[model samples]
Target: MTPVDTVDLWVIPLDRPGDETRTAPHLDCRESARADGLAPPRRGRFVVARGATREILSGYTGVEPKGLVWRVGQWGKPYVELRQDTAPVPAFNLSHCGAVAVLAVLRNGRREVGADIERVVGGRAERLVERFFHPDEARYVRGFAPAGREAEATRLWTRKEAYAKASGHRLLDVLHMPVLAPRPGRRPGRGDGTDTGAVRRLRDVPFDDGWAVSVAVMGSADFDVAPRLWPEGP
Candidate 1:
């Protein structure tokens, strides 16, 4: 609550029990919000986001999940009041793609984080990259065009989007980062590595699959990604 767990990721399989519900995973997040001494979220979307959040926080606190009051910013970001008198603690971000939702937790009062997931469909990856991304990024994928051009494009797109989301920059801002250079690569731990992964700048923004996974962290110190699945309550 005061400090924060180191940057790490916990990806949950939606197929598992207590891993598929909308709010089940986040119950743990709310517990942390409360354990940290924050007021529970009263209601609205904040409640849903809060619930999803609780599930991720559960990993750290290992506490029973509970519903708490939550608040939202103008841009639809969620925040839990850690205390009645003090301002909310560290900021958080959330993104969902099909069956997957990625949550980013920050410790240093971050204001926003946006993540987008796009499933790659056939050759659409190449076309999209040409249309939306910078010339350099396009070139990076083209280099791999002979072997498997589509996959190349998808990886660049996700990394680019993740970087954009972290920057809180608009879809247009992705251009600021070089698209031609094949995105910064992060050699997956050999065996368990993603087919696509790379780090951009010092923020550690990386993603795989031109399916277009992107995240922008709005001015924060720490970041972690947690995959949430609905939890079953009996």
Candidate 2:
């Protein structure tokens, strides 16, 4: 089990060779059917992302990846079904964009946790801010210079997405929600040493340039994020 105050954030690169072949065998029927229905690269990516998720969770649960069953919530969140398992299962959420997939696993007695990653695209930032962002969040993005606007926008976008996923709320419903307020004694954009120390607060997860990552969890206690790359499979 993960430490009570820690959330494991796994950053996975989905383009590795034989990713599909290696992970495919571990996917259950529904996932395989879903992959079969998708076209070219999307099918391949889906296979890798879902398969990798199962593999990672398996390491924690002592269950084979194929033995894991998933159930979806009314709000469209997917959760593992622990129908027959006696071991504790970690709460987790997954998001993938471009060639990278991110998973956030929480074993701290919190069931609501989410993670997201997005490629930074400057041209669409202003328009999205104007349309969906809260007034404060919009201003936060606008406060950045043109050169920095996209990264700021992407950061805020990921945070909002992570929160929405964690809360089981529709993205459209929470798009206007504010996420700009910083927790006491914490600085924005610094995930390494900053702790939200409470629920409903967003944490910015540092990632490679050109990509933005964020994780959100529910609870009224302090928690820290430990980011690590997904280890290469044998």
Candidate 3:
């Protein structure tokens, strides 16, 4: 887990995030928990995510995981208070959906990065498309179905979530914004540097059979995604 990796990411199961690797520190859960009185699912997942994140960060920072730390977001996004003599300038975002949580870290002068992954549950894809996807995107999604449609749906959902996550907001009130679309040969993830196509054929991101993973980058000349995974059951 050296720092030379290309915008590395770690997707850990909220249910069972094993020993913390210290790539990051789980510094947000306690405050969020007390403020919101988390639901069972959120509590469990958040705890595991925190433990692992802390462990990960510890490995990198040599900082142990036994303290109260605050990861306050300016306007609800990650922000760090600059300490004298410390050059704190890197970009990252955290997102969790269903039972999994992801930590995306970007370095080497990457300004901003966002990532999202969603399971293509039964009708959730179509329903979300109708409810939020841009109109033309809806039609484009219609061109595919239970067969080749997964990819499209995954792309839409991931793009949507990536933006929301990037903006430090959830999707509850984001439907009014413009929808995202596919540009062939675009970077593998949702964001990167792909331009939205004409007619905006972005009715929900295409979904793969197992999961839909999308990422986006804003205000950057070059952006990309590097993926990491941690399974729940050993």
Candidate 4:
């Protein structure tokens, strides 16, 4: 068995006042706010997520958050820019919904990561699974008892989205990719048995308060996912 590289994840709550201040100095919150054009509530969440991303990455890179450079891929994935003289660039992804944000970072030599989080909402999980999930995934979700369908659907959605992000492929392009079914008494495997060297592992992040997070990494089967709650700053 190969040694699994560990992935570091940070779950930050955006509802607190000081959340913005903690990472505000490291990101252009005002510009992001303007570009968002969303109503106040949504805009506020965006600011917190963006700010927290910078702060978290800064801690890992030892660079001022505001000094970090980023570029967006053709598929709209954001990545840190690396200078020729800088150390190896880390792989990271961020997702936010409702009042929480999730950030996943992988610094191993095979750095590639994607993560997503979604708040559980009633009455939409089945519909979403029907419309967006692969045929097998949809069937698997439907196979769950009616009372358990929503949570299972949410898990599948997050897993699929995370894999898509990690692969840098459009969500539609990867919908057909199969996902491993959750074992009766065990955790789901990282890969959904479709490992072609791009996405070889998956880890479901554990959180409280009805939110689900999933992370996908591009590497060998020996990789571990570690989740941490970001502390509230003064």
Best by lDDT: 2
Clashes of 4: 4
Worst 10 residues of 2 by lDDT: 187-196
- In angstroms, what RMSD does candidate 2 have relative to the true structure? 4.6
Q: Per-residue CA lDDT of candidate 1, range 1-234, in tens?
A: 655333333232233333324553445554435434533322323345445566555443443335334575543445655433443354555655544455665544534445555676687778888787767767667877454878667656665565555454444555445533323464211111111342333233344443445444443234445433333245
Model 1 alpha-carbon drift over 4 Å, by segment: 1-5, 15-50, 58-69, 84-88, 110-118, 173-176, 179-234
- Candidate 4 worst ten-residue window by lDDT: 190-199
lDDT of 3 by residue, 110-188 (tens): 4555667777666768777876777876776788866656566666777767766555555765454554434533433
Ranked candidates, highest lDDT first: 2, 4, 3, 1
Please give the lDDT score for candidate 4. Answer: 0.75
**Per-residue alpha-carbon lDDT of model 4 for 122-187, expressed as tens digits?**
758678888876777788777888877788788777877898888788888777776655564345
Off by over 4 Å in 3: 1-5, 17-29, 32-42, 59-68, 82-84, 108-110, 148-151, 169-208, 229-234
Cα TM-score per model: 0.56, 0.88, 0.68, 0.87
Tell me the lDDT of model 3 at 150: 57
- The C-alpha lDDT values of all candidates are 0.49, 0.78, 0.55, 0.75
Candidate 4 Cα deviation (angstroms), residue 46: 1.6
